[model samples]
Target chain A: SQQGEEDPQALSIQEGENATMNCSYKTSINNLQWYRQNSGRGLVHLILIRSNEREKHSGRLRVTLDTSKKSSSLLITASRAADTASYFCATGINFNKFYFGSGTKLNVKP
Target chain B: EPEVTQTPSHQVTQMGQEVILRCVPISNHLYFYWYRQILGQKVEFLVSFYNNEISEKSEIFDDQFSVERPDGSNFTLKIRSTKLEDSAMYFCASSSDLEPQHFGDGTRLSIL
Candidate 1:
C-alpha cells in the first residue's frame, strides 16, 4: 500500500532556481527518506529524517519533517540540468517496512 | 559505496509460468525488502525479510508469491503462476537499520 503522496505530480524549473517538493503521509512513521530515480534507473538514497527531527541538510539538499502534520518537504538548492529526475518519499514503519509515494517528477531546464 | 544488486535486469515470461527474481543486498545490511512498480504507478511493498525469514509481508504477497534467502547473500522472489498484471519492475532494497533503505536498479518483468 502507498502511505505517502507527493504534491506537484510534475515540476519544471530553470537551473539555479530552488526546487521544492512536498509529501504527506497517512500514518505515524519512524522516519522519512528521500530518493532520486533517473528515468529507468534504480533509486539513490538522498537523505533521511527521523520523526523527532524537524529538519536536516545534506550538501545542497534540505529535508524537513513535521510529525504532527505527517508531512515532509525536500528542497534542492541551485538545481542543475543533471538534477532532472523523479523524487520519491518513503516512510519507514516498524521492522524496516517502507511505503513509497507516487513520486514527483522534476525537470530542470538548463 | 556499497549497493544492492539485482539480476536479470529484464525478463520476459508467459502467463502461468514460474519466474524467479534475484537480488544481492548490501553485505552487511540485516534487513531485506522487495517492492514492485507497475508501469506509471506508485511503488508497492511486497515483503520484508530478516535473519533468513520473512519479517513482514503485504496483502499482495499471496500463495502465488514467495521469498527466500537460499544462501547467505542471495535473496530471491518466486512467482508460482505469473499473471499479466505481474508485469512490473521489481526492486530489492536493504537497510542496516529501520531508516534509509538502499535500493537496487530493479528487474523488469514482462509477462506475455
Candidate 2:
C-alpha cells in the first residue's frame, strides 16, 4: 500500500508562474522530502523538512510541512522551463526507508 | 563534484538470465538503497543496506533480489533470474546519518 498521495496528478503553467503541489501521507514521519525527476532520469533531491520544521527553502523552492495534517507542499516561485519535471514527495519513517508518492507531473510551458 | 555514480547506464538481457547492477555511492555515506520505477509509474523502494547487510526491504524485493557491498565504495544489486516484470529503471541512493538521500542516474534494464 502506498503511504503517500499527491494531489492534482498533473499541472501546467507558464514559465514565470508559480507551481504548487501537495502531498499527504498516512503514518508518523521522521522527515519529509521532495524530489524532482526529469523524464526517464533519476530523482534529484530538492529539499527536506524535519518533523519539527514547518517550512524550508532552497533557491526558488519552498517546502512546508504540517505534521498535524500529515501533509506537505512544495512551491516553486517564478518557475523556469528547466524546473519542469515530475515532483515526488517521500515520507521517511522509523524503518529508515522512504515511501514515495505517485508524483505530480508539472509542465512549465516556455 | 561528489555524487553517486552507476554503471552501464543501460542493460538488455534475456529472460531468466542473471544480471548485476552496480553503483558507487558517495565516499562518506553509510546507507545504501535500491529503487525501481517502471515506465510511467511511481518509484518503488526495494531495499536498504547498512553495515554491509540489509536492514529493510519492500514486498517487491523478493528472494530473487540481493544486494552486496563487495568492497569499499561499491554497491551492487543482483537478480538471480530476470522476468519480464523486472524491466524497469533501477536507481541506487545513499545517505549519511540523519541526512537526505542522494540518488544515482539509474540503470535502465530491459528483459528480452
Q: What docking class should model 2 receive?
A: medium
Show model 1 residue runs off by greater than 4 Å: none
Q: List candidate 2 stretches off by more than 4 Å.
A: none
Best by DockQ: 2
lDDT of 2 at A17: 99
DockQ of 1: 0.77
Chain A TM-score values, per prediction: 0.96, 0.95
Candidate 2, residue B43: lDDT:
89
Instruction: Tell me the tens digit of each residue's lDDT in model 2 across B12-65.
Output: 999999999999999999999999999888889999999989999999999999
Candidates 1 onward: DockQ, in order: 0.77, 0.79
Can you list the residue pairs that collide in candidate 2?
none
Question: For all the candidates, what are their Cα RMSDs to the real structure?
Answer: 1.1, 1.0
CA shift of A6, model 2, Å = 1.2
Q: Candidate 1 on B1-112: residue-level lDDT in tens?
A: 9989999999999999999999999999999999999989888999999888889998899999999999989999999889999999999999886657889999999999
